[model samples]
Target: MTNSLPEMAEIWQQTLNWQPSDHQQAQFQRLYHLILEGNRQLNLTRITDPQEFWEKHLWDSLRGIALKGEFITSLKEGASVIDIGTGAGFPGIPVTIIAPNCTITLMDSTRKKITFIETVLTELALTNAKTLVARAEEIGQQSKHRQAYDVALIRAVGTASVCAEYTLPLLKQGGLAIIYRGNWTEDETTGLENAVKQLGGVIEAIEKFTTPLSQSIRHCVYLRKVATTAVQFPRATGVPTQKPL
Candidate 1:
């Protein structure tokens, strides 16, 4: 059986404990069609089953919405946001669907992914979002993007330490960098503490939850950028991954 927009949305509302407006429902249908169309041209995603889409894609994306009251309040009022390594628009597209006020930059290093994202945005008429094809380090240093967003989000991109270097430089002071990690251990958190502090951020909270279908454990490591990052901190393109703090 195929899961239509209304069916998927009901699952979202039940899983996330929120209602979707009519406009949001329409946006879901748009996304469903766009993703299906894009899948034919390119390997956009492997989870083609509608149930898998609901669990992995929609619910995973809506997990951010669970934090919308606090972690993403700024996005609800027209704040700028960037989704680093937004392959196939995991959290960015769904976040845009729910929070129309946010202006999101969905960025990825691969041209094909950005092409897929741009195509979806155009087909869905999502005017509040844009695409950027660049590495995180390069985008961090660009005059237009540097320190430009209220919040930066990344999912399964890299280690917390390395992801901090890629994401923190793009946020203004007092902004948040939310990193999504799966099954994070205590040792992993301890290992990243120094890197977080070195990057002018403090570990705020590590929220844990279970995915709707798979029941997989997920972790959201929230860090607050308390001060500005040093100009030399990112240390050129690809440095963070090569020599993580």
Candidate 2:
């Protein structure tokens, strides 16, 4: 069952001009099983159909892997990465699947989500991935986690400001925090400037691309951490959402 999924992933990768290595093939197989099991027990995601999984779940997760090649290349093979608010392992699991050399920490506040991720990791034989059942804000402040990651990936999570607060603190200075968002206008970018600045990040770029099958416009906001976040940031969890910086 897992074997067929990688064949599908390879086809998808070929469509994007990417050729998966033998190791990547194995990873995709693991991802397929993980998603399948996760779907059975919890609302990890809504796109359960196999075809929809290929397009919406697999491809959507792989987009970050595709765009951040340069960043991934710079990391030490098996460097640490953290995915905050990793509701269903978007980007993290896919990234772990494609980039076998990198170790990933998939963190979500919900215990069921973490359990689902753990089960997938174990089933897929993904030795480099781990799941944390904790809030992003609390993890970002822990001495062990703070400024510990080489890259931080987030998706469809929150406002740019709030996202930055949650993600940037977990990154070492000069690391990158890639936020996946829907299409945004110039006004939205302008609105986020102060929050980005406040969180010690600079908007490096706002990359726009269309989904392979859907042709839906999507945006990836790349922010680079320039300095340490002030202690006040990530403000008590719910605060960041209710009163964004």
Maximum-TM-score candidate: 1
Tell me the TM-score of each prediction against the true structure. 0.92, 0.89
Candidate 1 Cα errors over 4 Å, as ranges: 1-15, 68-71
- The lDDT of model 2 is 0.76
Q: Over the stretch 1-245, how does candidate 1's per-residue lDDT look in tens digits? A: 15574355565666566766777777776787778878898887887776677677776776854563243567667878899999989889988877778899999989998998998898778899999999998878887988898888898797889988988889998888888878889988888888888888889888888886778888888888998888877778878888999
Best by lDDT: 1
- Which residue pairs in candidate 2 have backbone atoms (N, alpha carbon, C) closer than 3 angstroms, thus clashing? 78-101
